[model samples]
Target: MADQLGSARRLTTLDRLAGGSKKGVYRLRLDDQTTVILYVWAADENFWPASPTVPDDPFTDASGADLFAINHAALTAAGVRVPRLLMLDRGGRYLPSDIALVEDVGEVTLEALMARDPVAAAAPLSTLGDSLRRMHTTLGSHFGKLAAISRGEAAQARCAEDVVADRALGHLDAVATRDARLADAHDRVVAHVRHLRGAVSARQVYGLVHGELGPDHVFVTPANEPALIDIEGLTYFDVEWEHAWLRLRFGDAYPALRPVDLDPHRLEFYRYAQVLSLIEGPLRIAETDFPNRQWMLDLAEWNIAKALTPL
Candidate 1:
């Protein structure tokens, strides 16, 4: 990989980073002391795939890598702070799965920054809000996976309501199959989402969104700027969803920075859809050979119960 990037310097150090289910992250230091983050998409057939809640079909390892690369470029052009895409090999030519080499943003994640000092983190969190607003402002004519746009498939564009409806229905099916007790609540949420389809579909705004913007994926630079990472699930959808996730995740920790007026109904529906979508992960892992299978099942049940409760 270093040779491909035109660097003949031998790698002096390599350390694996923690906490990614779908990708292996590593920090590599060349003999010359230059550092870069190497991201290799997970290709194990049994490792599971990209989130089904993402707009359009779930992504395979190769396709997900391509989408991540495309999304990185698009987001960078939209004035959103993200790591520089130094090199990419979406075809898995040099590794077991597709790989990307990106500029190292530093060792600090937004989560750590927040924990270290909530008072000082305020400025960066606010800046993150602004970055997210810029991302939502980057519009697309179609409402689905951003990768589809590069393929000239705008004709298959869907309305935001339709996308959310499909995701909600899928979540309900997955959750109900794993736990029968929450079936009634799942059904009610699905029906409510269906009821709002007409109103949500009529809205005209469509823009790119970081479907998963948890603090782990947000890195705080040495200069105190927020840079986004792990963008495999970027898509075009109602911006309200992004704001809702931020508000739900951060609460009063970060000031609201939505670029447009948020509709209370739309925000609520999307929030439910978001929480429901999260249930799929634990349910899937519960069926695996993971040592913590029972724990995952318990967590899944807890999430299902939480989803059923009023927000």
Candidate 2:
């Protein structure tokens, strides 16, 4: 790792940063008093196989380091604040998968900041909204996960309704096997989604969306601006999807700075879709060797119940 930095300075400290599921992040300090963030992608097939059940892949044909570098450059160019890239190893000549060294923006995350003071956090949350609006301003011709290697088009764009319906079906299958009530709610949600297909087809606008923009992925810079990190799940979708996530996470207080008029019904549909997507994780974990399998199943049921509730 020190050799990759091209600095002969001795390593002083290495502290592992939390909240990563596939990759490992760490705070690295050199004897020369330089600090940087080290991101290591998992190379093992168990963690990142070529053909996984999930459709999304951060390292699209490119290596993880290259993908991160490209996403950082693209987001930064789009007027969104992101951590500055320093060094990257795309070929994995030195590491297992790929690695990158980036400037340490700050120790505080938006989640932590919001927890500390909700009122004071409003500014950063608003800044986040602006940043997201800027990101979504770059429109896409199609809808789905944007190819990491290319900016011009999506690698696998499909009908928006098709995507939602597929996910809804998966949620239904998973829940139906366990809970009958949740299954019935999922059926209603699926039918509602099917009915919205025509409405989705009529829409023309689509843009880049940070598919997973939870508080942890957003950080505060020393300048107090909200900077985005973890670009793995970056994709292209309706800006309303992003708005739905924001509304779900932060409530109706933070309004999206959108150019087009958004449909409330479409937003509600996407909200339920998002809930269904969230339930998939717990369901998958429940099937695994994890100790809290039953707990995860219960959590999935709870999310289904929430999804069924009126918005």
Candidate 3:
């Protein structure tokens, strides 16, 4: 690590950063009183337990330095701000998997700032709104992960809406086996999704989405710049999908991330699908050796209630 940063700025200490489920994130303190972040794509650090039962999709355990680099480039091109890339190690020279060195944009997430002082956090939050606009307006001819699409590796799979519906139903079935609440609400949930899905009109063009944008994923720099992180799942899809996430995470402040033309049917349906995903995903993680089992179950329970809500 010191060799990568050159001899002048030798690494003095390393501290693991939180919220990285698919990769190892560490902060490197150098002798020069500066810091940088290192992202390791090692398999051992990943928390998502692989399943042979589930059908594959774009959002499945989205990770890797290739995805990061591609998404970073595309997002930057679209005027969305991300951490500055210092270096990327893809060769087996470092660890078995890929790694990256990026600028330390600070530890204060927009979520934290908003929690600390809602009034003062207004400026940075507004900047994030612009970032979302740029990302939403950047259209892609086809839908898929930014890396796969860039490398011409994207499959001719079903449209984004269908993918959401299929995954929602699959999760519905799986969650039923694990939780009695899902088993009882199974038919109603299916009916709600199918009804909303039917109301959604099809479209050809797709826009870039952060896929899982939350205030927690946004870091506000000292200069008041809001930079996006943990962006490996970045994809080109229906903008409504991203809006659904923003509405959930931002809650009342969702209007800041703007677009007046979102389809109501798609937004409602996707929000429910996202809730189903949250329920199933956390339970799957809790089954693993990952710590914080209680919190994961709590999240699953919260989302389960949301999924069972009347439409």
Candidate 4:
């Protein structure tokens, strides 16, 4: 964190930067009248196992800033609402697998705004839907396939494979093998994800989608314009992955907006994928919110029963 005057100045101290699982974001005021943003290197150093003892291939926040900028540019070029790019740090060399940089954008994120008023949340949902439709209809073909080994697939085959493996052997025992329920109830989530995948994609139907569609990545500005951020997981395979995710997080509440059309079987698979993502991420975020583990168990049972149903 260094700050130099004139141009290409590095900000040592970010006024107010908040973040979650992956990156660090900051708000800065430039010499100009309008305010801009600065995003820097910030990744979980201890995220993966055995990395610390080894040569170190930790996920860097350095390269991602540029990638995110590029993604924003691409989406913006396609008539989407994204922060107007002022500058990108191309001069800085990477420290093997490290990333660090800043991007200047206008206004606050939809998530931030929604923090003030829950009812106002619906506005961003509609904008997200419209933006998604544009991306899918126009650039869907360019997105990566959501595979476990694929370049940018986030929580892909892991959850589905876990659940299927569990159910194949038995019920409870199988689930435990897939997920360890320690401080948090991970087993029930694993079972739920597997169950949904089995029910939906049981007959073999899968397709393209946004890959990871959640509120956190979607941004709504002061002007009420909706824009999508964080597209590292822009993927193709498993339409159900997107549908189920949107459903659990936002779909159930917003019935007026229908998820993209896919075959019944594929849709079901997506549902499971989403449930797994929520369990792994948001559910983890709200683990203590639930009174007991029974609540999670109930959700697993419900999803499993649904998955077992014929599509």
- Among the numbered candidates, top TM-score falls to 3
Please write out the lDDT profile of model 4 over residues 1-311, one tens digit for every residue.
22323565543444745443344455766544435565544444212112111111111121355455555555675666666555555455433333333344345565555666767877766766766666555533222333322344333333333343333223333343334542134445445555644654332233334455566565676667775655544543445446656666564444534446656765555454434333333223234433344555566545544533432
Residue by residue across 3-67, what tens digits does model 1's lDDT show? Answer: 65565788888998876566778999888787899887765523454444534532223235778
For candidate 3, which ten residues in a row score worst on lDDT? Answer: 51-60
Stretches off by above 4 angstroms in model 2 are 4-8, 44-63, 148-158, 178-180, 184-186, 196-201, 256-260, 286-299
Q: In the order shown, what is each candidate's alpha-carbon RMSD?
A: 3.3, 3.8, 1.6, 8.1
Clashing pairs in 2: none
Q: Give the per-residue lDDT digits (tens) of candidate 2, residues 179-237.
A: 67765665676676666554554565677787767777888887888888888667667
Pick the winner on TM-score between candidates 2 and 4. 2
lDDT of 4 at 216: 59
**Clash number for model 4?**
8
Provide the clash count, candidate 1.
Answer: 0
Candidate 3: list runs displaced more than 4 Å.
Answer: 52-56, 155-157
Report lDDT (Cα) of residue 261, candidate 3: 78
Q: State model 4's lDDT.
A: 0.47
What ranking emerges by lDDT with the best candidate at the front? 3, 1, 2, 4
